[model samples]
Target chain A: MHNASTASTTEAATVPETTSSVDSYFADHPTPPFLDNYKDRIQDLLDFHASSPRPIVLITSGGTTVPLETQTVRFIDNFSAGTRGATSAEHFIAQGYVVIFLHRRFSLLPYSRHYSHSTHCFLDFMRPSEDGKNIQVVDEYRPEMLQVLTRYREAQSKRRLLLLDFVTVSEYLHCLRASALLLAPLGPRVMYYLAAAVSDFFIPTKEMAQHKIQSGDGSLSLTMTQVPKFLSILVHSWATSSYIVSFKLETDPKMLLPKAQQALARYGHQVVVANLLHTRKERVVLISPVASTEYTSNPQYSSHTIDLAPGTEEIEEPLVEELVHRHEDWQSTSSS
Target chain B: MHNASTASTTEAATVPETTSSVDSYFADHPTPPFLDNYKDRIQDLLDFHASSPRPIVLITSGGTTVPLETQTVRFIDNFSAGTRGATSAEHFIAQGYVVIFLHRRFSLLPYSRHYSHSTHCFLDFMRPSEDGKNIQVVDEYRPEMLQVLTRYREAQSKRRLLLLDFVTVSEYLHCLRASALLLAPLGPRVMYYLAAAVSDFFIPTKEMAQHKIQSGDGSLSLTMTQVPKFLSILVHSWATSSYIVSFKLETDPKMLLPKAQQALARYGHQVVVANLLHTRKERVVLISPVASTEYTSNPQYSSHTIDLAPGTEEIEEPLVEELVHRHEDWQSTSSS
Candidate 1:
């Protein structure tokens, strides 16, 4: 396996020096339209954190798009459904941490994630009351709805969860940098959970088409540059002392662990959760500098999976619990 | 603007002759995994239609993804949210037609479209009862929910709507051809609404990477060939007598009408709905062989927009009504 650091360095040397720095990247790309509102929302979260002693965790979820044109009729996209990040946020909230969920717009969200993305139509969950004048949750779904509702209401009432969203890679990166810098003062009390499927390559703004590319020219050929490695910047400068957990998703099982280990060695982050495309929901491996452990939904390892009612499985429940325990241990050791 | 027909012909000549035929393209590409299930679904829909004199309209929605690799960690996508197709399906059912909705998985659905893809959380529409034992739709949204619920229940109980979905461009095209051939016997009684934003170019299966393309290779360069044009075959062979309505969405307003008209002349389809990327929800022009007419959401043309209470607007309401009228006219004229 290639060392990620060496690979990135070699690639960077070939590209213009101006494109290597994060600052230069932002200077070249147009600022996202909602930057002001994003900053204001971050401020609101910080204010809420100031009034409480709870640790704040920022969870970035979903896939980011790299537009092929300025007008963006076509783009490159990843295959993320945002299931891992959104599910993890709810678990973090349950562990009494304040969550700032920065997700892809219209992907998924905490609490609502249970039903919104299901194949069963939302209308199927509702039934008319006996008189047909009112609509109510079906009896079978009421208990689950109530559980999610109570948690959601508790979080809302306490102002513990702040939801923010982005659509494209540029918007995501800008918001990530701004949020990290804004929360820098919190030091170890802040945690960064980067689960988003960020684009590895992008067409630079200077070379992208001004409008939609017409197919009348016969074949379409595109050359995209590697996106600057931002994880190193996030760990070393943006939120230097924060607990950072990043994800490595791969289709090839053999590449999973090696790539994840390379990410840890390269960026010096706290944790790297590795998963395969086909078996992700059923299995995952958590790799840290000190240890590597596997979690699975197999019946034999029921304890490693969520302890829901028999026949019901949710791997995220156990995954989040494990992370929370690790984060707590890290907090105590570092403070001492 | 270049004529679409001439451009397609010119492009076709440059490519190997085998690449221009639909049959050859399918032979080169792997059949989508869901082909069997897709055929079964179409059979069910055909059985449903056999018993009813009601005309059937097949609505294809959302964007089809063109995969960059056979394993597919990443893909190229278009900017369609499937709102147009979902909204039109509901309107078609209201017009007393049996509807077949072939959509991108998790994009949107007819009744569920009202809430599923919205920025507002689904939980936002629910409130705990005074007793805290049950949940009900909030009073503010009850009237709307009731209206949608009634219609949804009516469609379900009457078995008037069948929902099928696809994700990749290959699956979409395969399903489309299968559904069209199955419905060919219905002739003018069937309508084909092709609204899915299909990729114009795709990397041939033979050339696509079997594993994720490593970014360590530095800049990524790709060459994609123009997708074979299937509309002409759909018009001439697949479902020749069906009322075919295709969509032309361009970011450039200047090219909209001419491209749409060219499509009509080349494929001999009945209608081509021309829309600009930015104003598609608010305005669209219906271009037929003889004339082109615009439809807008402006209250002055309320009859052309869904007549909700004074402030609310939905362009699909009027758009579907106009199409239903046109279909009815064509039905009568052809039957005579």
Candidate 2:
């Protein structure tokens, strides 16, 4: 099944005008161990989609690690907890979309996000029974726990969600490519939600220390090469018919809109969701080819932005709703 | 209560011959938000110790993060899951020591480590009732869960364990200093187990980028200054009467013994536990002023190293037992 797509990708491996091609990048770096199971997982997804014709969304979450050593005692890490991706996946599942959640190991998950990332310890949510023979969810939290559990169990029974995970940038890239190619047959019915905060720079595999770097030196100087831009390849070749929506997270407000616009222009993806580091939870700007609009949790922005009640739901609830609407429109247009 | 110690620390803040002192380092870096509560936590510890009169051990666990930017979209992270520190804390608590666990945020805790860091999902350990009305721990894991829960509750009820956390290197340093100074009144009754994998290099506050670094520049060149060695200050002034055990982790076999010896000689700490990155779980070397010895999970090294049958207990079990014996010897000799 992979032979034809692999051949086309290999043949399409021209030197990109700015940086190395995705094919060359894969060649230079060793594939992750989990890649061995990728074929089986993709086959399962394909087989499931054939039997069920719901729109499938591949949601990448959390932050990728860039190992400083081959043995890996130290690494460069991006700041992400996988909150966005996990929450978005739950929403997608509610919208009747099948979700393939590709997340960072130990990060939050779709159903588990609520309790997993809470400030309270897992044990804190449970209490000993009156007889002290068994433990159960605390009285106050039982209702909510049951609701989440029911949804999670329902999704599992229906096989609507698939959980896949990665740790390093290399693993994420390899998994992304393989998954994209596997889902290409679904065409515009598939949506790629790239929410993971992937590392921008990495020490090449060959250059990385075999062991932990010695700390005796007074100062540490590191030179890292930029990770080659793969979004262009992802859009143009791997999943050409899929609706691609990439994220742009910046600390500076000035850089947010500009960078998001540039990514849209360069990759020709359907949408670029721009966000600031501080206000990302409360606000986001969706930049499409024709128009850009803001979304906020603040009720004051109701006229211009998709204003959601402050505590009623998360910013992602509205954001994903808008995204699903746009994706439906794209599918109709493409089919026509 | 803190005035006398603050005055003494300020007077003792002479520029060190090799590296900057802890006082100067704190002066250079801004204090973390939790500093206000540090005193209260310390007072609580002191009051508890005064009533119980048990030996107190401050276990510093997990890896400290070094932020690349002030807002911190990316950071340099040391590879540690806090297994050593968390495991050791449980052992210490079992040995009747009051444990103050100062760990990195989101890292493992002593009693919680087993269920929390397991590869299986938290929900996997739980099952819905036959009637589908409630969730309970799966039958297979019930014995272990009950044992852990009983111990956790016992510790909480007795106030024998205090949990504190930090995220950044700066916060870790400040917290360490404050806690040590507060514990100094106990003199030889206290022990400092420094197990945290602290960053060797960090971007100073003034030099760090205010916003997320622009990735358009293709390549990234980062020059990080050496994190001022504060062990000298820790040994010379802060909690001087306390028996200090520091960790020296290296990937290179040749560097491990030498580095461990150097740290012992330079800081004059009671013990320096040396371990290779890969073999840390299975084996470790205890280097003290008088002698150096190995501790291993492998029974093959039983002749030279302290060896226990695998699966009987963690390597830390024997390691902590030996340390407690040594610490008892130290207390008697010093008093004499």
Instruction: Please report the candidate that would top TM-score against the real structure.
Output: 2
lDDT of 2 by residue, A1-336 (tens): 111122223322233224355667788787878786975886786697687769999999999999998988889999998999999999999999999999998788888778775556677777667777777788798877878887888888888888899999989999998898889888888999999999989898788799887766777888998888887778767888888889999998888777876675556567888888888888888876542221111111111145456775688899899999989988887788
Q: Give lDDT per model, in order.
A: 0.79, 0.79
Regions more than 4 Å wrong, model 1: A1-20, A291-312, B1-20, B291-312
Angstrom error of the Cα, residue A13, model 1: value is: 17
Please write out the lDDT profile of model 1 over residues A1-336, one tens digit for every residue. 111222234322122223356777888877778888888988887886797778889999999999999998899998888998888899899899999999998888899998877878889988888898999888899999988988888888888888888888889999999899899888778888899999999998899998889988879999999888888877766777778889888888888777877676566667887888888887877776542221111101011222334564777777788888878877776577
Error of 1 at B171 (Å): 0.4
Name the 10 consecutive residues with the lowest summed lDDT in model 2 chain A: A294-303
Enumerate residue pairs that collide in model 2.
Answer: none
